[model samples]
Target: MRTLTVFALMAVVLGGSGRAAEVVVPADMSCRTEGFGYADTNRHDSSKLSVRASSNGNKSWIKFDQLGDYDLSKLRAATLTVFLHEGKSGSQQCDVSAVNDDVTENIKWVDHPNQENPAEEIYALTWNNAPGNLTSDMGLLDAAKTTYIDTITFTDGVEGQGFEVEVLDILLADTDGIVQFVLHNSPNLLNFATHDNPTEAKQPYLTLRFAPEGADHPVPEDGAEVDTTLAQLAWTNPEPNTPGEPIYCDVYLGADPNRLLMDKVEVGPDVSGVAINTDNFPNFGLLANKVTYYWVVDCYDTDKGLIKGEFWSFYTNDNLPPEVDAGADQVVWLGMGEDPNQVTTTLSGVTSDDGLPGPYTVLWTQEVNDAPAVVIVNADQDVATVTFSERGVYEFTLTADDGDKQTSDTVQVIVGDSPCDASHMSTGEPYHPADANQDCIVDLADFVLLLAEDWLACTDTLTQCGMLLPM
Candidate 1:
């Protein structure tokens, strides 16, 4: 990413907040666990109250119930930057609101979006701001754009309720796994809160609040573990950097990086060490071609509100596959070891070059003379299984297809004897009538055997032969 000038930032923030003394809503909220990434556009069932990132995606916006718990005087105006992982396609919108904790009418809802959402609103940033939450878009900057810095404030309402705005929401979605976020504050306020708190996952995040123009927004000093050149930026804050109010962080990302050639990039943990799952970061689907670039980011820390970090770069060998026996066996069992008795057998060892996830197929064979079975085709998951069944050898063939070609491997196993014996009946002896081994029936064969075997007493036990009732 290039650099951004400070002047361009303030205008974007002011333009979005609307009138300084805008009529806000009653909003107060406690902590609520939420599902993130891809949110839904549909309203909440309980008045669209329970809001989390749905398939609707990273599009940012806050939704909650509102009533009297909020005093507009207690609410201050602020500016927030919504950042997303560059090269990633999704929504990053601002959310703000005031929800009354009241039951029936509204409950468990609280928040305000930076900007209102339009129906046809195809947003690069789903900006929403309400009585409580504040949102801003530094707007979109080209990869060649320079670093941007800014100061914030609201014009009307009450002259000095001590309102503030720093960086707020900081989120980046990437086909590439990294995101960079930055926050700015007034020089008078020595202390400041980070716009957003740390998020889950290993994606890089850093947050900082500079003292009165603190450090020209530290640029990536070059030669680091991440590429500063490929990262996007955003933030959130109260009208000014105030003390003990709400300085929730909100970040975002857009399509802009240095030189602007990035389509998508694979990103996750260092990923150089994970071995158990076969494919690295399989769930996120973020991995890319081998390359090097720089990145910068910020995060909300327990101690430091938002501490900013410098840009760094790291190189990746994205083309290598997991280290497994390609020529050897391709199956692994669950509980059953060398021999499995009604356990599971999974096909393994089919992977790819760039390590994107997979282009693997799960095939099965019973080893009974029948042709192999096609279980799953083009599955991103590596292993395929043949669950518990009758005792015998089960074979699985894993075929890996990478676009233009296919690679295959097989694994087989033997099932042990049945858990229950079929030949014996409830009695301690083998299953039979009065004449054991008489070919299993009381026909002529058994009659002859009965005559040879026993004699006289009449008893319920078949073993005792009584005065014969003519068969």
Candidate 2:
């Protein structure tokens, strides 16, 4: 188990001097456990978060989503700040621990009184009645052990006291893009403002500080047009990661600027280039032929600090030809029943384009394979009709033109004198339409079987007497 030591805890004023890269993210979800009025009821919408012990214990949990926005690898300090709405504590100690799962807002005290059943005691903070400052180091359990940093002292019991605790180790070890903490005080009753607090500024939040920044000049440049096959991305890192000081670069790429959840690439120290291919973009797929791609880079230096890069965009070339599918290879017979040689089949072709240079054109032409030549109506359209003059095999080609490029596909059409002539065989393999008995032959035996199976199976309501009316 990896453990993180809580180095310090201070009961400082809420407002303080801010850092350049400091980010204050409020808890998006929060809930408190009620043990007195309703132990099983969820207080997610409650404006106050209460923590107490005794028999009617009350605990609170706060959760923050999208932790990926901050670089945890280069996190220098993470302070959990909460506004004490109503509470007076002289020597009471409150502890905060990490939970295994992201607890929903509908959490109840009856679910787990002590903490969430799966909650892990990652870290805790203790404060005494002594004035000034105190240095208290405590260990918290996780995958590893814990260590303490500073001490927190609560002199006179008073309302509206803001508490700040360092929780760097907890945030650093989080794998999922979520940060959740549970607050518990066994002896003292304390109430804090929650995310639903009337005053938004008094709500609980986390302030994060990351490493320094770095200058990056991306290859191919931003907004440059490049080939579709370009697979590598290079950058000039003014401060490269050395052997002792490792750095990671997270690359986010997508067409939509809002949903750029691309993969992150961890580059070794001294390396300044990374490959941009399908292996990195599992959800985004491959680079399209003609598209304007947007990408951002965030680097985390183990020594100097972490810095996020600006958004860069480049357009891919669009000279590729259109794709086409000439439907499935068709199998048609001469004619149904009465007409044995007047077969007219419609040919449907599908085409796809990138809309690059402009619009495209489509045409369907007959290929001379085995035939006495066929007549095609509307040969310049994707859907055309072809009439067969003789019984043989034929092919129709559908070609698409985009002014600069042309692509074509062909479909085969087989025509015969009768249903048996075009498809029947002695091998009993290929489908034969006239083979009613399924013997692969169109003989008198098939007709006898058909009559015996469907002798008087007609669904005509008006002809109950079995007399047919002329239409």
Candidate 3:
């Protein structure tokens, strides 16, 4: 794992900066050369690439260019795919080599180099051969040569088949980005589709894979101080312009500058940002305040695997007060003769400390007021309920203490008088007749008061006895 991380870092610092790409073999870059002493015959416009032994051994060549600009030094792999249209014999062997020749698609049979010279010796094909098998006798050369690259065996009955060859070294060896190769059958004839084939999809092509580019444009800027522990980590894929499948990102974060002791967080191929709470890493303990933290993002091609990126660092802010958010002020009405507890309002507040290292305290306090009643508060919780015993405006403050510093916010509570207040009776205002005691409404207590005054005839001129009788 350590070695993998180092390699990934080097890739980011080196040439692994471009996206994966594919280059198709163009029609003008492919041609066939017949060896029947017909040196002047031009097969550049043929629809197929063929190699046969019947007519003095025919050979084919395909060249690919514009590959030098890519960072082939860090290339993961290079694949060359050719479509096989048909074969003349049963299981024919072919020799493929990276020859040092100045041949092009315009070269005619008479211009072919081997037309008058002795036929190129061929070698036998071997199974389970390592890549760049120069020692294997490909039957096309008199002695083993470094140019002999690979041997491909073709099945006679199968047609419209595709074969892939790993030609990474060959592509890297070409400094001009132009790669040329020659193919000849070991003994029999074999036909393969060329770039000019009617079926466009059957044309030969090359695919090169490299590590995904490093992360760019990070959030919060490197080597800066952040006020909050809940940092939003973000970065950009260096190869966003490269056309291919989505790339996956793995984020590594740690307090160590070397990033050896860190935690890994896997994100989506589509997501470029994630919020990480440094103070709340599961089972790893809270991140220390005033400590510098290091992080890096490693991107991967969903199909090709890890493409390492660079490392960035940032420092957590020094001791800071907790942030407090007191909920909106509340307005409530007190019913006549209602219990103070029944007329309660909740004072909601939210608090967050940059590095909540120890247990914090949340207290709700009521300021001094002129009302002749006590204010009861559920002081222990962040969201506390306050019961006002008198009708008036009350201000409550919520404070959060995180050992180092304290922060507070205020909320206003307005308690209004109810319409059924007993005090309104003395004001000579109209009131419900059933409210004998003028507390709120008619009830068993009012009936008891009326019974106490039963049979007390209205002898005074101010009393209306007729209305009180029986009715």
RMSD of each: 24.0, 23.8, 30.0
Off by over 4 Å in 3: 1-28, 87-89, 101-146, 215-471
Q: Rank the candidates by TM-score, best first.
A: 3, 2, 1
For model 3 the TM-score comes to 0.37
**Alpha-carbon shift of residue 421 in model 1 (angstroms):** 10
Instruction: Write down the worst ten-residue block by lDDT for model 2.
Output: 126-135
Candidate 2 clash figure, as a count: 25
Better of 1 and 3 by TM-score: 3
lDDT of 3 by residue, 7-45 (tens): 001012234333333334342355665543443454543
Q: lDDT for model 1, please.
A: 0.29
* TM-score to true structure, per model: 0.19, 0.34, 0.37
Q: Provide the overall lDDT of each model, using Cα atoms, as 2-decimal numbers.
A: 0.29, 0.63, 0.60
| Error at 452, model 3, angstroms | 99
Candidate 2's residue-wise lDDT over 122-151, tens digit each? Answer: 211111110110112111223222223233
Comparing 1 with 3 on lDDT, the higher-scoring candidate is 3
The candidate with the higher lDDT, 2 or 3, is 2
Worst 10 residues of 3 by lDDT: 1-10
**Model 2 lDDT vs. the true structure?**
0.63
Best by lDDT: 2
Candidate 1: stretches off by over 4 Å: 1-296, 299-306, 309-391, 401-452, 455-471
